[model samples]
Target: TTGNISFRNETTFGGSGTVTYRWLVNNVQVATSTDLNYNFTVPTGATMPYMFTVKLEASNIVGCKTVQEKTVQFNPFPRALFNVVQARGCAPFNLQIGNQSTNADQYEWYLDGTLVSTLHSPNNIVLNDFDRTYTLRLLVKNQYGCIQDEQSVQVSTYPYLKAEFDVANDLSCNGILDVQITNRSVGATTYTWDYGDGSPVYVGNNPSHSYGRQGVFTLKLTASNGFCSDIFTKTVSVSNTPSASFTSNVRSGCNQLIVRFRNTSINATEYLWDFGDGAFSREENPEHQYAFANTAFTVKLTVVNQYGCRDEVSATNFIAVSPPPQANIEVAPARVIKVPNYSFTFKAVTTDDIILYRWDFGDGTSSDRSEVTHKYDRFGTYKVKLFITNRNNCTSVIEEEVI
Candidate 1:
């Protein structure tokens, strides 16, 4: 490195003709000229100050002379260097600059070609834009008001985050309320979930959860990437559980009853019926056959909804079936009776459970008795029919000929 120095002579010589000048540094003469001002260059020492004694002598053609002496010193040029704490970070980023300049007495800081600070070290610098880059420059000067060196660095900002999540509006199925969460955030590295069903908070990208009961609930998710955070919220719902109920067209009958069942289930998607006679059906509404007689049956219904919730109902002794009575007719006289003896007795020898009876003599006369005797006016043969009914409204008939 090198520096410049200048010397001036302010001397007066009387009676002078063609005055000459002599310039010397450290007692060594360097130039002998008539010039009053002299400019010189010298090497800058390593981390040390350099001092020189400058002398000037003036003489004319006469034997008259004048001399002046001065001491000069040269300081080293300043070198500017700095480092940025963070080159790139998320939005609203704080910037830190470390000043590593040498031999500087004054400092000037510039951001994006604009002077921001003149102190040796600036403080509290922050950048608030996303996906942008900025330039920072440092200018340093020595005590001589000489700005000789400059340093610059770049600071960049990362993109901001937009947090979002997606889930089904209705999470009910078969009866159970299960939810699936999807993270749809941009520029996020972590996630949090609040199911709002009095459950524990969840952490991760996507998760599966089940609610203890069915109703409406609030859902929330938060996404973060160490620079920014975002939140999403939604209202979700769950359906009710299934209830089982049923009805029948006829609850009781006799002799191979065929019953038609009607389903009245609520919030159900599937149904099962147990006829209690070793028969089952999976239809919503089913008709079952009861081929056995004199039997009482217990029916059951089971229902399930889309969320897999189930319910069941049982009807104890829901149906009753009875056997028909056996009908028989008997006459005191033989089947072949003589003319004018056309009187006969009819009897209901049916099952003892009989409740009522009917007799048709085939001669335009009738009787409503368990046993009856009737007479024919003509000598022709006649048919006598006997009908019997039991407690369960079951009927049977028998016929006999009389002459």
Candidate 2:
């Protein structure tokens, strides 16, 4: 008669009766009991005069019942709460951490996939490194010795990406280093590349690249769907190759001019020369003789590479030629008639250039006076125009009149 009631109950039998029980808290009915234990939450207060009363009732065949009440003290201690603050870095070094419950008793840590440590305070903690998974958890026990729930997340990191290689040092080549890519994100599904050569190049691990010119480069690595990326730069030393030189000259002799071409291409296999004289020749060293006087000239060279690639260069050159004297003109038909038309002949003689001539008839019409005739449509008085040019580019002109 002085204890809390429960279902699995034991009591001393006194009289013949049907036994049942109902429980109440804060003076309100909450549960029915037929055994020793009765379920009910204690009214919330430690100092308050809260009570849990167990009732014993008895009934006989006469339909008459009698009851008695018993009560005991009900008290429960408050529970403590614990949580994790942050988890970072790789396993073993995962550094599992959490804040201790203000009145807590102990701490524990798990990393990657395993539990490794238990401590008494909220200090820095390291977890197990034996697992390959990227997630880990923390555990804390309150003053009442209650364990905390688990917390986890996935991390992206690569510890194997250390690089090693040498630089390229070629004059005619793109100066790229012999570097390599390594898959350090353990258990990664795929790999990507950015060779820092102006484009995103994709290849498997240990990939190599060549640059277009000479300079420093910034290389980058992005792995695991861009989950992690790293950048580093390196300077490459490159040198310039000197270009070969070419020179051509012209010399004059009796009735002939000799043209000469030369160069300093030790790597070239063949050379072509365009003398600008409407003539061309192919040889390492070339010589051409011309009987014509000095004229405008352009000397060209086509240097053929070992790979058959050719580069052509041309230089303009001028020559000094002797000009012939101008010829004297003679009018054959000194007089002519026609109010509206006249015809006459004119001639000139030049010993050096006989085929080159100009004619100036007394009429207003004229022609190259080598031995030319002209007619004037309106001939009251007329003046003529004559022009002549020789192969040496020497020119002579004459004008005449008739009435």
On lDDT, the leading prediction is 1
Per-residue lDDT for 1-403 in model 2, tens only?
A: 1234454434434567665544444455555555544555554444523456555554445566566677765433322334434433433343434443343345455556566566643354553343333554555544543334444455333333322323343223223345544445444344566666576677565566655655445555444433333333344333222234476574333235665656765445677777766877877887776555535565667776543345666666533334444665566567555445555666665565545555544543345436766666653766665676665555656565666
Worst 10 residues of 2 by lDDT: 165-174
Stretches off by above 4 angstroms in model 1 are: 1-202, 205-239
Give the C-alpha lDDT of model 1: 0.80
Q: TM-scores of the models, in the given order?
A: 0.45, 0.28
Which portions of model 2 miss their true places by more than 4 Å?
Answer: 1-40, 43-107, 110-191, 205-207, 222-403
Pick out the ten consecutive residues of candidate 1 with the lowest summed lDDT: 40-49
Residue 359, candidate 2: C-alpha displacement in angstroms = 93
- lDDT value, residue 246 of candidate 2: 71
Candidate 2 residue 89 Cα shift, in angstroms, is 9.8
How far does residue 174 in candidate 1 sit from its true spot (Å)? 12
Q: Write the per-residue lDDT of candidate 1 for residues 141-192, one digit (tens) a residue.
A: 8886554799888988888787787776455634456777677889889888
Q: What is the C-alpha lDDT of each candidate?
A: 0.80, 0.51
